[model samples]
Target chain A: MNRKVTPAALALAFSTAVTLAASPALAAGDKDKGDKEKCYGVALAGKNDCKAGPGTTCSGSSNRDYQGNAWKYVPKGTCKEIPSPTSPTGKGQLQPFQEKG
Target chain B: MRGGGAGAGLSERLRGAGGLTVEERWAVALLDPEAPTPPDLTSWNGSDPGQRFAVYRNNVVVSLVESLAQTFPVTCELVGEEFFRAMGREFVRARPPRSTLLARYGEGFAEFVDGFPPAASVPYLADMARLEMHCLAALHAADADPAAPQVLEAALREPECLPALRLRLHPSLRCLRSEFAVFSLWDAHRGELEISQVNPLAAECGWILRSGLEVRLLPMCAGDCDFVEALARGNSFGEAAEAAAGDREFDLGRCLATLLRWGMVTSVNGIK
Candidate 1:
C-alpha cells in the first residue's frame, strides 16, 4: 500500500517549489520600480528633481543627494552628460554639463 | 616609368603596406602611442619633412598629455598647468598607452608618482592617484541587482545554519584605505567648496560607489572598511559582522543600513 512518485512528477514538484521559493511576493516587473521612477535629487540647474527616466543628465552638482553619485534620472528634453567627447554619448548632441570645445 | 628608380619600387610597396619596422614602431609609439600607423614619408612627396614631422610630433604630444591631464585632473590642478604638462611628457615617455581606453591608460601612475623626483615633496600625491584609479575602476564595473532586505533578514534568522551566505557587492563599489587623506585632496581640487577643511597628513579610509551615474566617496571607520573587505571576499554576513564587531566601534545596524541605502548590496543568498 506504498505509493511512489515518478521521476518526472518529482522533478515537476521540485521545480514548482524552487519557483515558489525564489519568487518574491511583489511582481517580478516591480523589482526596479522604486529605482526606475522616483526622482531622488534636483538637477544643478534648479530644475525639478528630474524624473528618473532614460536619457537624463546627471553630474556632481545635479542634486545634493545624488551629487558625486552616478545614475540620475534625466527628464525629457534633458541631454545626457558626457565627461569627454570620447564619452559613450557619441558626438551629436551637447551634454548638459559639458562646455563647447 | 620615371618613378621606378633604385629601391623606389620596394619602398613604395613597403609604404603602401603601411607596417613599421621595430625601430619605426618604437619611434612612432614614442611620439604618439594612439597613432595606428607610422607616418609614410612618401605621402609628403617633396613636402617639408621638418614641418610635417613637427606637426605630427605636436599632435602626438598634445593628445597623450591631454589624456594624462584628463586621467589625473586633481593631480594636474595641484601641480599647476605647465608643470603638470611637463610631468605628463615624462610619463608618456616612460609608459605609453597599452590600450585604446584612455580611462585605463594610467594604471602605473601611482607607482610612477612614488618615484617621481619633483612629486616627492607631495608625499600624498601617489596615494591620491591610487584613490582616483580606484574611483575610475568602480565607475566602470558591471551592474548588479541588489538584494532585498527580506532576504537578508531571513538569512540573519538562521545565521548558524546559513552556509556561507554569499552577498554580492555592487559592481561600482570600491574601497581604498590610505595613510594620507587623499579624498580631501581630490575634493579640494574639485572646487566644490571654499575653505577646504581636510588634513592632508591624516590617514583615511575612502570608499567609492556609483549610486546612479555619479561616483560618491564615503569615509569609513577601520572596522567598517575591514567588514567591507570581508564581505567582498565572499564571507557570510554573520561571519563578516563577527570580524567587523572585533573592533568596538563597529555598529552592525548602522553599517547594514548605510549599505542598503547606497545600493551597495547587490544580492544575498543561502535562505531556504
Candidate 2:
C-alpha cells in the first residue's frame, strides 16, 4: 500500500533511457523490407487489406452448399500438444472439440 | 429486368411483407440457408429462382467465413482449416456484419471463440484470436512520429518533475496479458521457435507495435506489462514505475530504453 517511486529513481531511469531515445527512426529505404517482414502474408487469399468493400453477398458464384454444424471436426491444430485436464490420462490428447448431440 | 406486373406485384407484396421487407428477408436468408427464398423472385432465364438464390447465399456465407479465416489465421491454423471454416460459418451466421467496413469485421470473433462450445478444448484459442485482432488493428492504425530524445532530456533536467510526467505511446502499440504462453505460441507459429519448446500453460505477457509497416510481436515480462498498462491508463511515470518496481525483475531504465529503441514513445507530456 505504501508504494512510492521517488523523483531520483525517475530521473535515473530517464537518464539511462535518453541514449536509446536519441537514436534515429528507421529510414524510408527500410519500407520495402518492412513490407516484406510483416508476420502475415500481405496478400491473403480473398483479402484486399481493408481497401475493397465487403464481398458481394449477391454474387452468383455457384459453390457447393456446406451444411451441418462443425461438430464433425475435432481439435486438430497445434493445441493438440497443449495439456488438457479433461484428458483421462492427464496428458495432451486430441479430444473431439465439439459437443456431441 | 423482369416483366412489370410480376416485379411491381413483388414490390407491393414486399412492402407489406409481414413486418420484414423483401430485401431484409433476403439479407437474412443469405446468412441462413434454411430460410426460404423471397416469394415471387425469378432468375433472368427463369431457371429455378431457388438455385440462383442458393448461389448468392453460398457466396455470402463463404466470403464471410473466408474473412474470419484471414483475420484470425493463427486461430484458423490452430483448429485447422476445415474446422475453422465450419466454426467461422457458425460465427458468421450467428453474428452477421451490420457495417460495410469489412476491415472492422470479425472484431468479436475472439469473444465468439471463447464461448463457442466446440473450441472448449483449446482454451488459449480465444486469446490467440484476440492477439491476431490486435495485430490487424495495429497494421491499419494511424501513423505517428515518435518523440525525439530531446523531449526526454528536457524532462530529465527537473528530477522532481519526473514523477508527474505522462508518456504517450504510439497508436499502434498494444499489450496483452494471458495465463497461457500466448506469445511463445504465436512466435512458434512464426517459425521462430519449435512447438516442443513451448509450454502453453505458462503465463506470458506480450506487446505488439508497428514499427514502419511491420507489426512486431515481442515478449514482455510481467513487470514490463504492468508498467505499460499503468502508463497506458494515464498513470504518472512514478506510479507506473512503482507498479513495476514491486517486481524484482523489473528494470525501469531498460523498459524505458526499449520503449524508445522501438520508437514507441510518441510524446512526453505533463511536465512544467
Query: How close is every model to the real structure, measured as TM-score?
Result: 0.66, 0.76
Which pairs of residues collide in candidate 1? A56-A74, A68-B215, A69-B214, A70-B212, A70-B213, A70-B214, A71-B212, A71-B213, B146-B266, B147-B266
**Interface quality of candidate 2 as DockQ:** 0.29
Clashing pairs in 2: A77-B78
Off-target runs (Cα >4 Å) in candidate 2 are A21-101, B1-18
What is the alpha-carbon lDDT of model 2 when measured against the actual structure? Answer: 0.72
**Superposition error at A68 for model 1 (Å):** 21
| lDDT agreement with native, every candidate | 0.61, 0.72
Compute the lDDT of residue A46 as modeled in candidate 2. 38
Which lDDT tens digits does candidate 1 get at residues B10-115? 6554443346554565366446546544444444378765466567777777888876776677777777889889888888878877788765678888898888
